[model samples]
Target chain A: MLVIEGLTKRYATGDLALDDVSLTVPKGQVMALIGPSGAGKSTLIRCVNRLVEPTAGTIRLGETVLTALGDRALRRARRRMGMIFQEYALVERLSVMENVLSGRLGYVGFWRSWFRRFPLADIEEAFRLLARVGLDHMVDKRADALSGGQRQRVGIVRALMQDPELLLVDEPTASLDPKTSRQIMRLIIELAKERGLAAIINIHDVALAQQFAERIVGLHAGRIVFDGPASDLTPEVLTTIYGEEDWSATIRKAEDDDEDEPPAVEAARIAAAD
Target chain B: MDAAAAARAWRPPPLIEAAWLRWAVYGGALLYAVLALGTLEVNWTRAAEGLERGGRFLGAFFPPDFVTHWLEIEEGLLESLTMTVTSTVFGVILSVPVALGASRNLAPMPIYLFCRGLIAVSRTFQEIIIAILFVAMFGFGPLAGMLTLAFSTIGFMGKLLAEDIEDIEKSQAEAVRATGASWFQLLAWGIQPQVLPRFIGLSAYRFDINFRESAVLGLVGAGGIGDTLNSSLDRYEFGTSAAILLIIIAIVMVCEYTSGFIRRAVQ
Candidate 1:
C-alpha cells in the first residue's frame, strides 16, 4: 500500500509542476493514471519512487515514511517497488541474465555484486523469470540485439525478478506496436494476477486502459479530474480531463465501435508533437 | 532591381575608412612591434655560431657501429624493454580504480574530484621530473623509471577512460539505478560495459607512450638504455649513439604498429 499527502512540486523556474495533491494506491490493484502529455503524470510517478524529490509532501510506502526517511532508509523501502520504463532501460551491453540479475542488487552488497556473487536463490529466480517470460534462450544474448517487444518483455521479467510487492510501469507499451502493446498489457495483467502484486500504470492509451485496467484515474493541470471504474470513463470524462471536448468526443465515439482499431503509432506521434 | 542589387553589393572602400576597432587592432599590433624591436636583439652572429656548432655535433654521428660493444648494447636494450613492459603492465593495473573514481557520471562528486586531482598532480610535471624525484627517493634504479611511467600512464589513461564513461548512454545507468544497485554495482554493470573497449584501447596507447618515456627516464639515473645513451653522449661516442637511436626508432615503430592493430581490433 502507498499513501501520499499534499504532494507539491515546483521547478527551479518557479513553476508548480505538481500542486497540492494526494493519491492512494491500495495493495494488489492495477490503478491506471491516464492523462495527456505534460499533465504531471511522469512527475507524479517519479515522486512516488523518490527519483524526483517533491518540494513538499509526505509519502508512506507501507510503514516507511518515504519523505521523512534518510537516503539509506528510502533506498531500503524502494526495494519493495519495481519500476518499468518505456524505453525498456535494459543495459545494452549486459546480457539478459545480467540485466535480470540486476534486480537483486538492492539485497546484494557492493563488492559482492561487482564480482557477481549474488545468492544462489536470486540467480535461480532470475533464470526462472527468464523462463517465465519465454526468454530462456536469450539468457546469454546482449540486450541491444532484442526487438522492442522482446526488450519490453525482458523489462517485465527484470521487474518481476525483483519479487517486488508493487510494480510501477510507465508507458509500458509506448515504444511497441498495437499488438505488442496488448500483449505487454496482458502479460502485466497475468503476472499481477498470478503474483497478487499491486500495480500502478501510467498510460496514454484510453482504449488500452479500457481493455485492461479495472479502475482508471484521469489527471489534468496537476489535479485529479476523474476517478471511476473503467466502464464509467466515458467521452464526457475524457473531454473534461483533456480540457477539450470537440476532438476527443468524436474520437471517443469512433473508438466505441467494436470494429475500430486506433492508430497507436500515429496517435503517439501526434501526442509527442503536442 | 539593378539599383537594389548594387546597393546590396559591398566592398572595402579605403584604409582610412576602416572601422575604429580595426584601427585600434592595427595600432595595438604597431605597439607590439615597437615593444618587440626594443626588447629583442638581432644576433645573427650568435645564431650562426649555434648552427655551426649543431652541424659539427651532427658530423660526429656518422656510420652507426652496432657490431662493437654489441654486448653492452644488448644489455641496455633488454633493460629498456623490461622497464617498458613492466611499466605498461603496472600502469594499466593502477589506472582501473582511478578511471572508475574519476568518471563523473559514475562516481560521487568528492571521489571524482579526488581522482581527477590525483591525475592532475601526476601529470603536472614531465615524466623526466617524476623520474628524477623517484631516483632521489628510491636511489637510482629501474624501479624509479617504472614508477614514473606508471604514474603518468595512470593520469593519461584514467582521464581518457573517465571521458569515455561520460559518453555512455544515460538510460542504461538509470536502469541500473532503478534496480537499486549500489554505486559500485551500478558502475560495474552499467559503466564498465560501455567503457571497457575504449579503456583497453586507451591503455594500449598509454603503453606505447610509456615505452618511449621509459627509455628517456634512464637519462635521469633511473635505469634503462637512456643510461647508456647519456654515457655515449658524455664520452662523445656519436657512432654508438646513432646505433642506439636506430634501435630506439625500431622499438618505437614496433610499438606504434602494435597499438594501431590493437585499436583497430577493439574498435
Candidate 2:
C-alpha cells in the first residue's frame, strides 16, 4: 500500500513539475496514471521512491515516512518498492542474468557483487524468473543484444526479483510495437495481480489503461484532475485529461472493428506523439 | 527580371575587415623574419666540412657493431621494458580513484576539485622534467623513471576516464538508484559497465606511451637505454649508439603493436 499527501515538486530550474498531488493505492490494486506529456505523472511515480525529492509533502509506504528517512534508511525502504523504466534500463554491458540478479543488490554485500558471486538462491531465483519470462535460453546474452520486447521482459523479471511490495511502472510499453505493447501490458497487470502487489502504472495509452486498470488517475499540468474507476472515465473525462481533441473519433476508430484498426495501434500512435 | 536578379545576388562580406591591422601583422612578421635572418651568423664552409666529418662518423656505424655491444643493448632494453610495465601497472591502479574523484557526476565538489588539482600538477610538467626532479630526490635509477611515468599516467588516464564517466547515460544510474541500490552498487553496476571498455583501451594506450618515454628517461640517468646511448655518443662510439637506437626502435615498434592489439580486443 502507498499513500501520498500534498506532494509538490519544483525542480532546481524552478519548473513546477508536481503540485499538491495526492493519491492512494490500496493493497493488490492496480492504478493507471494517464495524462499527456509533462503532466506530472512521472513526477508522482518518482516521488513515491523519493528518486526525485518532493519539494513538499509526505509519502508513506506501509508506515515508513519515505520523505523523513535518511540515506541509509531510504535505501532500505527502497527495497520494498520495485521500479520499471520506459527505456528498460538494464545495464546494457552486463549479461541478462547479471541484470536480473542485480535486483538483490540491496541485500548482497559489495564484495560479493563486485566479484559477481551472487548467492546460490538469488541465482536460482533469477534463472527461474528468466524462465518465467521465457528468456531462459538467453541468460548469458548481453542485455544490449536483446530485442526491445526481450529487454522489457528482462526489466520485468528484474523488478520481480526484488520481491517488492509495491510496483512503480513508468511507461512500461512506450517503446514496443502495438501487439507487443498489449502483451507487455497484459504481462505487467497479470504479474502484479498474481503477486498481490499494489502498482502505480504511468501510461500515455488511455485505452490500455482502461483495459488493464481497475482505477485510473489522470494528471494535467502538475495536478490531479481525475481519479475514479475506469468505467467512469467517459469521453468527456478523457478530453479533460488529454485536452480538447478528437477523442470520440479516435476511440471510435479504435473500437469500431479489429480489422479496421486495433486499439493498440491508435493508442500507441497517440502515446508515441506524447 | 534583370534588376530583381541583381538585387538578390548579394554575397556575404569577408570576415576580416580591418585591412590596416592585417597588413601591420604581416609587416611585423616579415620584419621579424628579416631581422632574425640577418642577425644569424653563417658558417657555410664550416657546415660543409662538418658534413664530410658526419659522413665518416656515420660510415663507422655501417655494420652496427651488434656482436660486441649486444649484451649492453639487451640489458638496457630489458630495463626499459621493466620500467614501462611497472609504471603502467602502478599508474593505472592509482588512476582509478583519482578518475572517480575527478568525475563531476560521481564525486563531491571538494573531491572533484582536489583530484582536478592533482591532474593539473601532473600535466603541468613533461615526463622528462618530472623524471629529472625525481632523479634528484630518489637518485639516478629506474625508480625515478617509473615514478615519473606513473605520475604522468595519472594525469592522462584520470582526465580521460573522468570525461568518459561524465558522458555515460544518466538514466541507467537513475534506474540503479531507484532500485534502492547503495552508492557503491550503483557505481559498480551502472557507471562501471559504461566506462570499463574505454578505460581498458586508454590504459593499454598509456602503456605504449610509457614504453617510448621510458626509453628516453635514462638520458638524465633515470635508467634505461638512453643512458647507454648517451654514454656511447659521449665516447664517440657511433656503432654502439646506432645499435642502441635500433634496439629502442624495435622495442617501441613491438610495444605499439601489442598495445594496439589489446585495445582492439577490448573494444
Candidate number with greatest DockQ: 2
Clashing pairs counted in every model: 0, 0
Candidate 1 structure quality by residue, lDDT tens digits, A1-274: 8888999988788878788778888888888988889888888887887777899989888888888877776667667788889899998878888888888888889887778788999888887777777788789998999999889988888888778888888899999988678768877888898898888899998878877888888988888888888888877788888866554544454246334546774465334222
Model 1 misplaced regions, further than 4 Å: A11-15, A70-72, A110-112, A115-124, A231-246, A249-274, B1-60, B106-110
| Residue-wise C-alpha lDDT for candidate 1, range B109-174, written one tens digit per residue | 999999999999987989999899999999987889988988888888888887888888887777
Which residue pairs overlap in candidate 2's backbone? none
Residue A98 deviation, candidate 2, in Å? 0.6
Question: Cα miss at A265, model 2 (Å)?
Answer: 15
lDDT of 2 at A8: 96
For model 2 chain A, give the 10-residue run with minimal summed lDDT. Answer: A250-259
Supply the global lDDT for candidate 1: 0.82
What is the per-residue lDDT of model 2 for residues B15-82, given as tens digits with 9 covering 90 to 100? 66688887888899999999999999989999999999989988887777777777887788788888
TM-score of each: 0.82, 0.88
Best by lDDT: 2
Ten-residue segment with the worst summed lDDT in candidate 1 chain A? Answer: A265-274
CA lDDT of each candidate? 0.82, 0.88
Model 2 / residue A230 / CA error / Å = 2.5
